[model samples]
Target: MRNLIFLFFIVLAISVTSCRKDFSTIPSFGQLEFSRDTVYLDTVFTNIGSATYNLKVYNRSNKDITIPTIGLERGNSSNYRLNVDGIPGKTFDNIDILARDSIFIFVETTVDVTSVPDPLYTDRILFDNGTNQQDVDLVTLVQDATFIFPGRDPISMEIDQLTLDGEPTAIQGRFLEDSELIFTNARPYVVYGYAAVPANKTLVIDAGARIHFHDNSGLIIDRDASLKVNGTLNEKVVFEGDRLEHVFSNVPGQWGTIWMREGSKENEIHHAEIKNAIIGVLVDATTSSTPTLTLKNTQVYNHSNFGILGRGTSILGENVVVGSAGEASFAGTVGGSYDFTHSTFANYWNNGIRALPAVLVNNFFTFTNDQGQEVIEPRDLTQANFINCIIDGNNNVEFIPDRVDGATFNFNVSNSMIKFNDINGSFTGVAELDFTDTNLYQNITLNGFADFRNTSANDFIIGQASDAIGLGDPTAAAQVPMDILGVIRTLNPDLGAYQHISF
Candidate 1:
């Protein structure tokens, strides 16, 4: 009985010690360490939530410390929200930190455009009381956008989807109405899903219009519909993902392509920039008999796939610049007709191993037949001409001219800088890419440097030291009198989309 009572007393003592509270804490003396002195919330649209960011708070002292108050400087009026440890609130009281321990503080924001007094909304996370206070700065840029999203069904609650063949598709999108057919520079347009142009309708974008797409969102032109971008030299139309943050500025594949279906005729884009997409421009089934699209003084950059994909389509390009694609910068596949004058097609992608060349023109496509056997289908390549252009990349062979037996393949490259190194004898038996054939290749500078001005900065301007200076065909220069930057090309013109800069 005595031993049992002793064991019971010992167990009771252990339980009491464990249940005892340790409320003793020294006030924080402004010695709190932070993971970052300034937390940038990136950029967010008006009334849209920002990506969640985190910051760590450390207590270096050996003794436990109590923060008198942890809150935003603006208190309840601030647009920011803080989650201290696990609890979320605008302000917290008596937050304690164990000895030499740290806690994570998550930050998020959603601000209204009208509520923000300036472009940048700022606040501070304050710690402790008057004399023993420490603070971490917070900053975020807020932009106003005209948002367009699909509506949900009233009864079925099904999200709106793109229509194809009289049935809804998995693509979350809706067709544009008559009133929304025109876009202006009044505000930046933010598209949530695919904004499809209805059949036989035209979508017009005015100069200086900025169109931003969300993830997997893009613009699509339906059959018999057209797209017209009326941009000018001073005011260019911009198409990109809606991240708006500095980190995502040059990132690729944030959105989908600008796809133009067959029968979408008379499409034009001039002095515009299209970037950060899976494919900058995708032309499907637009045959080479007539001009499918006209691209002039435009820039396409940082695409995950081809910069300009032409599937049996015809395109007339002048002073067009394409840059940095995972696949070919410009791909004219399935036997398309392409004419590019005073243009630049360069791929300096450092992302991964690229199997495709910078520029490719093929006269055939392959598919599996009913017997599950691969079959080649040939299409006639009417014309693929590159005059006074620059087709160069990091690869040894930057241009590929593919030809199949059933189709007629015609191509000409005159007074251009190209990169074609067949050191491995890859084309020993292929007659399609014969460099000695003067009829197909004329005045070509084989494996020569164009000497671009800082390709890493996406600056394709030709430097004075470049050998391509004064190497352009005079007739082609006369056709495209002005360069992409509105500089008049002299009779002794330079190759590529941009003219030679003295610097």
Candidate 2:
């Protein structure tokens, strides 16, 4: 009787184990819920990979269900790809989800225009099989682009790099060829690395040309080289990052700057929009008496650093607007000659705490020497003038004049609106900060009302009630007769870049 009882207990344990293994999942019956009915992957340059997006597959029913087949409508040849259960493929089978739970389906795409056969690349992610099938639509816009990248060595796998000061550097770049001097508007140019202009050569960008740069990519004009951007009022040139997604449109520091390096001469940019860069335009130090950079009717916004940073260079600007920078909107450091008329330098930086002013003018800089000693270099600021310009921001001080006393710092800000509250008395006893001086600062409306239409949206048009509507100097307005947007400025023009307009 004891042996029989032990055998019965063993059989009971086996039966319980078999019953657990017999549990089953129900087949999906067109009841799967999805996060969205369609996924718009956004526009992208051809042959460029898009940002990854996810779709949540929820099983709201009480029973655990198994999707028999999850496949793309185009089968294995589709441009779209899927990742399920740590495996990547175009088709998956037996995808199971628990009751009242959800599983994510990640999607990505890299398509070529030539192979897509159509401008709109469409695909569908089909779940299950036969009558119980459910699908999510996938759509993307593919754009053809003229790709520019540095050449690589086949054997060593080494990419061409820029050499600085007779030493090899990690900056991946190559000088542009002779045939690539002119950039037209036929197709957008997508640059993967720094495209350097050869010495003594000139690169011309025609109107309506769009230049998109990847991370760290920029345009560098070498010694004696020049760059001319001829954009019209209606068809303006655009320089921005390669990301065409909506969320990345206004994000700053996506790429580098359009650097007119040291010794580069006669750089001119007109009617261009430069955004989402470390620096919109960088005019390095030059000994030439003429203007290093001529910027006219240009708008530079959403820059991580200065919109236009001039270092010991001469800049002549008219009808220019720079808005919202992490640092200054326009920073003339190390003693540069700047002459701006009918321009606006506004900084309503909302990203984080910004201690610097919107417009910064400093004549001195410090650096460490070879012998470990810190040395101070003060250059003469021959001219730092802003006529009929508005330099304002959310900070108490939007304009700072930093002089080291060892150099000649001369700035005449006449007929302009400025924001200098001096909340902490930091500029107390500073000769340059004295706003009462007629020679340095004249006819300035300090902290007066300059009602911008919408600073958050970057629309800097002044309204009728704004104090700057008729505060401009007539002589200065004549230099920049039209506003940045091609509107004719009145005889008594506004102080900022734009004339008074109805909101």
Candidate 3:
């Protein structure tokens, strides 16, 4: 009885193991995958016009699969035929199977929709391999017709003729409440030409906003209204042309000007990039007592005339760059109280900074003029103070003094560097000044003219040598603690932009 019971238990265990082996030996196939399951047509089309679309078919399986034919079907009905060769209604004959390969197919077809009817249509591409078939759907929607013109159009023709009073008139542009104005490229509009401040309105621009001008479009701020444009460092505002190719050319009077009209007050422009304009910023005598044009960390480049042409009443300019200009980068005519500091004026066709009377310049960098002989032409400048600055002039050119009649020009320089030419004969006009220790050169040139007065005062301290070391007011030697290049000023101040540091 014990033997029979053991034999029955052993046979039951063997039968269970045989069933597990049979289940494990069952065959399973991998999944079929595709790169894309849907296609989208972004444009809305009308009439019998045709559009071409590119489709990429990827083989994702490990084994190679053959695609014999692919055709488009609409609503379970073949509306149009797919072309494999040159003709329609043919199977793709030159098809091949490849493992992990992608093939691009171009499908060009005409729409059967008539007239200007807007509708959403669903179409699909069906691929057939004898009995096996797969379908990929495509969705497309048609929209209103858009006309593309060749070049920029006139500003007046582009915008709707709506006046400020909500009346029907041929007003060229519209102004939003958020101080934003959009100008289309239909017609060119001359701002500040017909009306200043957009017909009795204050112009305020948002930070990081862009004011695009069509070809030959400009704005002027009349004496009545004020212009306030303040931008942050990251999102600085821009005044640019609509088309990238159509920049403001170097032609005088080509575009309009910003005339701070008489009686206009409290105008502030900061952190802005004004590029490729005819004349960048023009400040005239019409400004009021409280009218202040404060330009800070702003860049003005590629202009026809001066970068900032100012006259009269307290303009504060700091950290500004005027580069690649046609004429003078800064042409300050007549009389204006200017407090300009920590600025760079470079690569101008004419003078870098042309100063008249009543200008106080401090802590600035002026590069050599590539076109003219002079860099900073101070014409009768009254009390021009240059502290901690760098002046570079190429071609052995001198800092020209403007020949203005009856103007007293006083230049006070401390801690600055001026180089005339590079070693390779490139014009890098940075002048060397050393004020810490007394060392004499064979010949010393002071302010473009040879000056042997106190030749011992030009020596720089060892290890504290710079281009702008001891060029400060010699009489006020005790007052200037350090040079412009951040070196400690000794008994005598350095002559150049940098002070010599021991170590």
Candidate 4:
């Protein structure tokens, strides 16, 4: 009797183990739930891979279910790639999930224009088989670009280089043809090398046109050439690096600059967003009586160096916001003519050791002569006028006026909020920051808290308690009828690029 009882116990244990091994293979019908029914991957350039997105496949039932098949409806011909539950393939079979558990389906795409029918690429991720099949739609807008790169001399395989800043650097570049000079929104332009606009030519970028550049590539306006970026409030022209990956989104120095060479004439940038560059707009030697670059309702930010570096150039900027640069946000160096109204120059650069201020006005620069001796050359700053503007930065003093007595340092700041604190007389010796002198500065609030809506995120919009509200010169505000966003400014408007907008 004892032996029979022991054998019965052993058999019961074995039966329980066998029952545990028997997992329910019956596929759960209509039991699968997804985080989203559709996934939109947004816009990506042709022949480039898009950022990976994920779809959560949930088993909401009480019993474990095995999806017999999970595959793209388009099969192997589809441009979209998928990875199901850690397995990468176009088709997956028997993907298992525990009760109340979920699995992730990763989706990515690198599509060629020729392989896709329409710019709006669409595909579906189908789950299960036959009647109980459920699917999630995958859609992405693919854009075909007119790629501009230097052509090699078929015999020599040599490309042209650019003589930038008196240094000849080997760069893959070519002059733009007449047909390519007029950029439109019909198709984006992805430039791999520098696109030089020849002398006497003009490159007009229409509103909503997207211009993407590769690393170290930029647009060069030769002598007598021009660049007119006609952007609007709703649709602004975008100039950025071609690295569409999320990692490069806010990075600085991704590309070169919109270099308006010494004699480039009548270059105008309006309602444009120029970002992620070494120098946003490098205006060189514009000595015209009229403004060389008329920047209106434009934003040039996230530059590694100066946002708008005017080396003896003339600029008349209105409703401009320049933010976050390794050096100064707006540098009028070696003297230049600059008149900024309703503009904001805020530098909250925590990237590195930023020694310069937000706005730098200097009248001279030191350079080595042929004999290797340091020679200071005078470049008279005819005018560095800031009216109804907000110039603030993380530093105690955001405005720097480095003047050489021999050269002229003509600057006027009226009805503006500046961050200048010289309690220690660090900058008080300079006449520009001497609050006692009304000729150089007037009605300027020193070290006034801008009360920015969000400084950490580079949002310069002011709040109710901010000192910038109603601090603008009504006369200057009348000139810039509208703010950067096209909002009609009141007679007594707030400072900065944007008008005082309440939430």
Candidate 1 residue 501 Cα shift, in angstroms, is 1.5
What is the alpha-carbon lDDT for the whole of candidate 1? 0.90
Model 2 ranges with Cα > 4 A deviation? 1-24, 85-87, 152-158, 164-167
Candidate 2, residues 223-252: lDDT per residue as tens digits?
A: 899999999999899999999988899899
Q: Write the per-residue lDDT of candidate 1 for residues 1-503, one digit (tens) a residue.
A: 99999999999999999777666888888899999999999989997778789999999999898898999999999999999988999899988898899989999999998976797999999998788899999999898988878652223223788886687789888889999999999989998888999998999999999999989899999888999999999999999999877778999999999999877888999999999999999987774366789999999999999899999888999999999899999999898789999999989988999999999999998899999999999998889999999998888889999888999899999999998888898878777677778899888888877889878766789888887889998888998999999999966889999999976
Query: Which ranges in model 4 have alpha carbons more than 4 Å from their true place?
Result: 1-37, 55-70, 83-88, 92-105, 113-115, 126-136, 152-168, 233-235, 243-251, 350-353, 367-378, 422-428, 456-458, 486-490
Q: Quote the positional error of residue 184 for candidate 2 in Å.
A: 0.5
Candidate 3, run of 10 with poorest lDDT? 21-30
Best by TM-score: 2
Quote the lDDT for 465 in model 1. 83
The positional error of residue 159 in candidate 4, measured at the CA in angstroms, is 5.3
Evaluated against the true structure, the overall lDDT of model 4 is 0.87
**What's model 2's lDDT at 124?**
98
Residue pairs in candidate 2 whose N, alpha carbon or C atoms collide under 3 angstroms: none
lDDT of 4 at 238: 95
